[model samples]
Target: MADSTTPLLSRSNSEAEPETPRLAKQVPSLDDTIERCIGSFGWAQLLQAVLVSLAWVFDAQQTFISVFTDAEPTWHCSRPDDPSCNSSANLCLLPKDAWAWDKPSRTSVLSEWNLACAGPVIAGLPASSFFVGCLAGGLVLATLADSSLGRKNMLVLSCLMMSVTSTLTAFSPNIWVYAALRFVSGFGRATIGTCALVLSTEIVGKRWRGEVGVIGFLLFTFGFLSLPIMAYINRESSWRTLYLWTSVPAIFYCIIIHFAVRESPRWLLVKGRKDEAIETLRTITTRNQSSFRLSVSFSGISIVPETFDGNLYSAIKALVEKKWAFRRLMAVMTVGFGIGMVYYGMPLGVGNLAFNLYLSVTFNALSELPSSLLTFFLIGKLNRRSSLLVFTIISGICSIMCVVVGESRQVLQVAVELVSFFSACTAFSVLLIYTLELFPTCVRNSALSMVRQALVFGGVFSPVLVAAGRKDGFLSYGVFGLVIGCCGLFVVCLPETRGGTLCDTMDEQEYKEIIASNGGDDV
Candidate 1:
């Protein structure tokens, strides 16, 4: 055997046995190891990737559920001669008997809790509470995937918590209880999207990263679209039915995750679990190949010899320590904040449109299809910086148009809003995938989580604006436009990582940056 003293990445081993002196046993980094294991994007990898990415479906459902549950049911004059329910009169000013909701009182939170006459702030509380929980959950659970729990375990925990909380939300007796449950539900799902995307991309080969990224967004779109359908089916029933519909499937999905999916091999290797990493890689990549062939493939492969027996927040500390990483994190989070504003705002605020609620939400959800398709097909060709810039700029302009159109031309306003939402959806898709490429594998989950939280932070303001905008358009739609357009400017500061390999360490990343800066030659 070659001397144990020799390093894994040495260029030469001239002092080795003359018989096999040139057969140098160079060690592979985690990226190199994954690339080799996943020689081609076979059905196995796709199945596993899809399984992991499916978490976004539930995440999207939980996110937009309020669109239906908290919706202010349409109302009409109770008596034909009653002028008290005229368009100009405030609903709060009218006698309770002057108007009646078109839908059953059990179909919505506003009617159930007698909150329809509550001011916008109080009416918007449940949605805002959910986002606040997401913020808290993100901060509290940020590093778990990167450290103690690992990606698969974190995903399981998040899905389970989200499902459990949502199931309980169905039984909420009052607005306060509903809002509190929504908060806890938000906390439970805070990491679902991040963990799903991070874990999916990390498990497969780099060649399929963009493809895998699109899968998650597509599934998320599916989830978003499903909400409107569930609401329509239960349109005559209680809103509580919607919660049971989404939560029960998600709880079962947790079981599927437990039995079918494998943890990310890159994550395993990073945590110093060599045998587990190798075994996972084998199971994912090798369907027909024998274990002996897999062993040959792993003959000279080795990890970076790193240990993570440190505290729970080691990855966060590593990110804080690296100046470039910190800068990258900040820039991306800023952009995510902008994207989040429109992404979460538009659907919740769809009620503001004079158009049909179910159709409007369906249109908004349908817009995600083209966005994902565009990103999926052009993922290889699109410039991250340019695409992000263009999408957000277009979204901002269209959002601003919602103000110009006013209520005079309702059709035109909805059209402009759709365009803005479409562009924002496109930006949102690109931003999450782009984030996966920005940081090293060790801190990727944590970094993505922080960025997602920033997006959630932007969402925290959306419900308040959407509620208030019932009177002033600018407070909701106009602000969504400005935040996305302005915050998106931060993308210019980050380097383009399209087509780049994943780095496992800060030093490796610095080396790659230096080589890139030097025109592909080592300095």
Candidate 2:
């Protein structure tokens, strides 16, 4: 029986009975809570994701447009007196051939400017210049997405700038002006994929991130597939018209992106805009057919707490400060450099084959579809390290075989080239997904931009090789095989990221230590 009026055993008895200590409520992290809110996806969320990914479709157009615009048009010598103008003769002589272009002179830069007789260095300048611009643009503009611009703003800005410059590029009266506009367009294009990738992934649930990322690749392939059709339709039209049509539609697309897409909630939280982040999350949950509420905002809810150090040097410094991060960057960039060279070089080399240029480009673009499907499958089921290693190795071996098979067997050469391109596409797709897992949200865009820069850097040298007028496998196939094979070795250094949660800061990304303590290896 309890004593109601006996003072509950008085002060002495109360002191004798120990009180139960209070356990603090564990606050959920921004990522964890956001993931819960997004939950299973609905149609609205999917539509939003797809609309943003349309940027990649336009990106593909800008990226490979040079293949058509800068093609070396077929020509025959008009000078009956020239002895070196035959098919078997060298076409590199500047003064020998008064050329008659098979197509309109304005259809390609080479014929428009009579660069067929020009040295390789002079002839390859515009293509090389475009990649150089891409490299520089990636390096300079990467942090804007991470720092102040945020993902949607940076993406919209890049799309508009790229569209305007590409449109203006069609009006260039001379080679110098043409090359300059390409450089600026490349600069604007540098962040388009980076922004689109980061923003789209951030808005989705963990289970759906890989799926959404693959959609970007698929859309890019669709855009690539469209190029040959457009080229065929305007086969008789000047290359300038191609630029106008592609770039004009892109401008209208950018306006839609600006109005429709929301900023990345992860990035908003990282930048300390709690209210905006909450609003963005609310929008995401609403679209996903869920509801979320936060009566009390967290006092320190940074998505990138480890990256709060304010400075222009923070992104690079973050990578350099950690030994593991630096190692990861080097390994990924090395692989990226190799894959990038082959990826760009393959399409350019397609023109050198015996097939029709339009058919060849279509085949090359089509190769991306199967690779995308394989990538989608592998990304979900396979470990990142092993998948990346296997794909790159296979790509390398197939590439080298193209050289061994020789172009004399045209069917075999083309078959080998397509296989190599297909494998390269798979390697590239996996590499991108793997990279997203390796880096934290704070510097993910910057880190990825560097990786892409390495790829563009590899492309910088491709135009020179392509311009050399050699179909021999050594420069294109052999070199690509060797580089990718060797770079694939770096895969040993990276930890597997399959089924692992993504981190928002550098410390969180290096989970190897925690895994080791738990009696498991990252492999």
Candidate 3:
């Protein structure tokens, strides 16, 4: 083997590279090593992947819980016979005593904090603060999973922080305090989805790679679906009850992860922890497949960290310094920004639909069922770049159509909104999978986090848009359409990674690119 300066990659798992001694001939990739050691997906693999995917459920809970918690409860004439309160007039315009919220004032933050009439800025503050925290956390914590914390530790810490902050959020005395606490919660959970996706996929064989990502999507859908149910159950209770319900269970999940899951073997191998990687491989493999080894072939498997300086920012530096990685990053992020806008905005803006909030949200969540199932069955047949482009376009078209359909036909508007959200859901899932494939394992988590940050960055404005859209559909829905439509075009700039190999370092990726360009799988 050459010195550490030699840049090399293991051969494809399915075939050998044509000999080229100058390039250091064919060697088995860690992925190949993974298949040899853990040939089939076993019970241990299933449990760990399922456990990681489960985080998507809780993360979804946090993402959409505000839809119910901060909602402006329905108000009506204090007495049925009261003429002073007109159902036709704005609640803000009427005298305080003329009307009352249909539900108890404690049912939501809007009535409890008197934010219904306090204007959009104050009413939208908490949700906005949460997304801002997500953006900040994404930027700051993006590399930690790829660098020091490793996927398991990063996930546990993120879940713990998010849960504790959510628990404290239930006790906020005022709106300002509530908004700040929500910010902390958002910051804590920022890396939850990113770590889960990266860790889950890394632990499995390539045959299950795309499937694992979709499984997370399905769980995320389940999580989204659970919110409306829980909120409905606590409809008569304080908004605080919903927060407590979701947060407490998450704390228990964190403990289970600490005891049950192992760190990603690919991540361990990247950090040069050979023994631990071997142990992880052994644990996830079947009882019959006992001869797990990194092997002499793996002895030459050179993995490098993202950071050149060996500092906290090294991984990011690696991503940006490399022209190809930087280009891929910006393009995917643009698409994510659009998807995030429509994805988050539609749920929050359901209030503007002139339909029942609970039923409207239920319809929105149920849309995920078909979309996820389709993605799962067709994942192998789908082209990562094209799937993203088509879904984003479909989502944007339906979103704009929501405004054109108008509120006169309530069912139609709701249906169109559901379609838009469905496309966004599919695009969101495909984009996450695409991000996983585009970047290799070495800097995979950080790159995925940045893409999610782009998604969150788009979400930061959703509350404000939803707040304004309460009066006009265009501000939120219309803008959501235009942005996603334009951004989806960026997909053309990205390479199609439908059947690409998972390389360990940037150099390996460059080698893959050379092979791809030369019209051969190897040199």
Ranking by lDDT: 3, 1, 2
Would you give me the overall lDDT of model 1?
0.84
Model 3, 1-523: lDDT tens digits are 3332233353446765575744334333677667656764667888899998888888999988888999888888876676656654688888788888889999999999899989878988888889999988898899999889999999999999999999999999999999999999999999999999998889777777888788888998899889989999999999999999999999999999999899998888878888788777777776444433334435666564333665677888989998889999999999999999888888888877777888878888889878888888888789988888899999899899988999888788888889899999899989999999998777889999999999998888787787788778899899999999999999999998776668777767766767767797642
- Residue-level lDDT tens digits of model 2 in 372-467: 888776678878788778877888888888878877788988898898889888888888888888887788888888888887787776665655
Model 2 scores worst on lDDT over the 10 consecutive residues at: 20-29
Candidate 1, 160-252: lDDT as tens digits: 999999999999989889999999999999999999999888876777788888999999999999999989989999999999999999999
Show where candidate 1 strays beyond 4 Å.
Answer: 1-28, 86-88, 292-296, 299-302, 305-309, 518-523
Ranking, TM-score, top scorer first = 3, 1, 2
Question: Would you list the clashing residue pairs of candidate 1?
Answer: none
Residue 314 shift from truth in candidate 1, angstroms: 1.7
